[model samples]
Target: MTRLSRWLGTAGALALAGLATPALAAGTQAGTTITNTVTVNYQVGGVAQNAQTASDTFTVDRKINVTVAEVGNATIVVSPGQSQAVLTYSVTNLSNATLDFALTTAQQTGGAGAHSNTDNFDTTNAKIYVDTNGNGVWDAGDTLVTYLDELAADGTKTVFVLSDIPLGRATNDVAVVTLTATGREGGGAGAMGAALVQTAGANTSAMDTVFADGAGATDAARDAAFSARDDYTVSAAALTVTKVSKIISDPVNGTTNPKMIPGATVEYCITVANAAGGAAANNVALTDVLPTTTTYLSSFGILMNGTVTGAACNADGAAGGTFASGAVSGTLASVAAGAARTMLFRVTIN
Candidate 1:
């Protein structure tokens, strides 16, 4: 027989010896005859001692049980930024056995679409979720942070809140995470006890949970509630310029050009205007830089009119007389806002 079988066989023989010894012994008393009472118990033995021999058989049953302790609460922190808040959640496992958990967030009901699983949570199986709305609690459709695979007894796990949830969404924005412990085989026997068998398929039901405050209760939730207050304002408009018109005479009306052989002369009129929004200062001057192609004419003169005043001239006038050979400069004297002025000049073309 194998070692295990030999050990069992020895134990069975010992038990039989103990049971049969008393029945086989008999003694006589001093004054009376002695009587012996005996009982026989039969069993099915593995090996027969002789032909028509009997043996003994016994049955043994065993079972195993597994239990999990409670899980510790989690703390969540959120950072401030324009795009999204970065949330961090820390949790601890208090159970003697390893545990598995998943994290999920509340969802928003109206307006824009919901947050996608890949975008919000780090993993699909079990994870942390950031209630982007900052309502202080999780609603359906919120983001999932991701799962923490396995946490050993008294171990801790941390999850990151990658994005900032906007403020001004409804209240109760929250960050949530769930940790679950699955019932598994333990030390003892081949069959499992009540606890393990009962939770066989619904392993996730033994989850430990944590949640943020109600809407507007936590910092994250308050920030989301007042997001609209941080908005900015902008304005715009158009600019325009007005046109000026005037006439110029080819020759002076009553003067002759001294440089020409005949009585030829030229007169030209020009208009100027302040097309911009502001007024033109009196000291702001106008100039006509004479070109090499133009010839000087002594009979020429310039006349000023309109909003500007100061210098005016006739053919023999002192203030403005004969065309200069080169440069010419003069001030507008004054020009009202959005107003126009005119000046006339007479000279032979030459």
Candidate 2:
């Protein structure tokens, strides 16, 4: 008996009994070959005829999708002069196939950031890195990558943007950074994949590229890219230092409102004040170099953490500082916000 066979160019009905459908998290993988075959059993003139079969086969198209979201809900707290400050984000591949993603960053200028704060400053030396250890924080083991390599479908990766805060940034200053990931082809090992081009005209026998990514902070819909924004907020100490000097006595005029004459005892007061709503200043070192004509008193008269009395530092402080190499130096443990600490010492005119 002869059998009839035919090829189906398009989708057709198939006859399969009790076929089991596999459960998939990301649906059928891209580049998967799906084929359907139908078998026909019939009788011609009361005689059994050979079974006929027709089959249709096609490859699954590539659906490019990704999501980029900031890891935390709050803005990253940073301080002036801080180095290697990190802003974390997670990039998840929602595509049906493994892919490489090209990562890029942008600095928002004078606009509201993701946290609704006005962006005022730009962080310096910004760079992108992948969290190689699956940890959200950036570490020495993390690789500095310009793009993610061969991330599987439904896989999530932590990415970090490290930057340097300038030394003179003010408190409450915000720097907004945007991260964008564009989907690319994946096949090469240890290297970035080529840029993806969406299939324009018609479906082919091979897998076609379809962009299914949603709109993000900086990208448009169906662009095969996603973006997210995160900000760095400065929580720094605003310190102010003020120095005042007063004469205590002279060689001729005793302690009765003495004048600034030769051989006069003069007192110096140094105040360090931190602004309100700012971070505390710690380990403040106050130093004063004595002039060539003036001489530092030999006794332990240098007072640290003194009390401020009417625009002048009083001598009711601990005498724990040192005077050497023609300089008077002391350390203030801390100066809290809206608070001040003073260092007072006395010297004599030559």
Judging by lDDT against the true structure, name the best candidate. Answer: 2
Model 1 per-residue lDDT tens digits across residues 1-350 = 24444455546665675686553111111122212222233445765343332233322111111121112222233312223333344444433334343333333222222111111222112234534454544445456544334444455554333344343321123333222222232333423222223223422323212221123211132111100001110111111222222223334443322333233454444446554444243444556655554444544455554333333222231244224547554555655545555555544444
- In model 1, the Cα lDDT at residue 209 comes to 21
State how far residue 53 of model 2 sits from its true place (Å).
5.9
Q: Please give the range of 10 consecutive residues that has the lowest summed lDDT in model 1.
A: 226-235
lDDT of 2: 0.87
Measured by TM-score, the strongest candidate is 2
The true-versus-predicted C-alpha distance at residue 291 of model 2, in Å, is 3.2
Q: Candidate 2, residue 341: CA error in Å?
A: 0.5
